[model samples]
Target: MIRLPENTTVFDDGEAVARAAAGHLRTLCEDAPNQRFAVCLSGGSTPKRLYTLLARPDYATLPWSRLHWFFGDDRAVPWDDPLSNVRMVREAFGTPSPIPETHLHPIPTADGPEAGARRYEATLKAFYGAETLDPARPLFDLVLLGLGEDGHIASLFPGKAALDETRAWAAAVPEAGMTPFVPRVTLTYPVLASARSVLFLVSGAGKQDPLARLSQGEDLPVGRIGGSPLWFVDRAAAGA
Candidate 1:
């Protein structure tokens, strides 16, 4: 497990988080060749700021067409529902909208959570194309995530079946203790560990305790990553 430094830059408010994502995305875009710069995103309030920041001119200059968006997880709710991650991302992409729906690879949540996860996993395989996502040799370019107050990332909540999943990279597991939505789609740790780069967006005082615990090597889902997780923390969330 890798440990985060005590004095990482604090995005003053959410601005810091936004700038961090923008810069990293611009760099990633520049690095990839003609192929798509595939990025799997977390569904949470944390990334909303980053997505909004990308709408600006500086961030907007990325090769949007050569980019593909995938979700780290999603509620079983309909796309139009308030609990929809798809809605959040599309809404965040206002104005010129960086990419079209053709580029957005949302998991099929409309097909009920369980079925949606299955369909989405198939889509993921297609996205990887020739590279193929193998649990033994995972190699995602970038996997962006958000820190849940309860230490969850993606749909891999504490004690969620997916947490113990060592087989499938993407799967649907029973959702209990979860709010209203039923089963959800998620990317397992084995797949996450294979990523070349992992970026986390954390904000709010509500997240500080988890951040502290995570930094102390707590066995939280987001902390047990096989690869490094570069956290973009905000001032209030980092604690004094």
Candidate 2:
């Protein structure tokens, strides 16, 4: 088996992982030098719990006004669809959240995955105020990611052409490797790497094989992520 990175953290279960992630997010926001903070969020059942935890009173009082939210990836579905990542996030936050409506940027899926990818790329560039990414500047303060059972991160499935994307900020996946099998729009590896930190939230026994592959140094899609990534996993997923 591949060795677990030094940055890996194992929890008793999914709930503990979520609590820790919520606390870390607050700290990152609090520590940012600039008033504005950009965070890229991942979509999955694991991260859903973290989002819900953040909505709690203890974590909800963070500087929501200064925080700008972006999605790392999104399925090509209407925002109101049951499978929509934006809808999941909105539901997790519940009503009357302090986070401003303008701060929450969701990938537009009404126009199809290819068009949606282009639109989201434009949105990221506009927010970053430049057509090209500057590694020194870093596009996001923190990017929260989730690892799929198939070893995919965000929507960058293994063997997908999107994994080869080196310059584009975003790209469209015409087909997904797993069920739901819907098209998707995702930030490219370059864009994901331009972050101060990338946190992978992994849970459930289903993730064990992927985690093992990662530990064995297999060049999976998740491994393509540049910079150091901290993986927060539960005992079951970690095989601890």
How would you encode candidate 2's per-residue C-alpha lDDT over 41-106 as one tens digit per residue?
999888999888888888757888789999999999999999899999999988986679999999
lDDT of 1 by residue, 131-164 (tens): 3556554456678887777888888887777788
Looking at model 1, the pairs that clash are 11-16
Error of 2 at 29 (Å): 1.4
| Model 1 per-residue lDDT at 193 | 63
Runs of candidate 2 with Cα error greater than 4 angstroms are none
CA lDDT of 194 in candidate 2? Answer: 90
Estimate the TM-score for candidate 2. 0.97
Worst 10 residues of 2 by lDDT: 1-10
Error of 1 at 149 (Å): 1.1
- Residue 126, model 1: Cα distance from true site in angstroms: 1.4
lDDT leader? 2
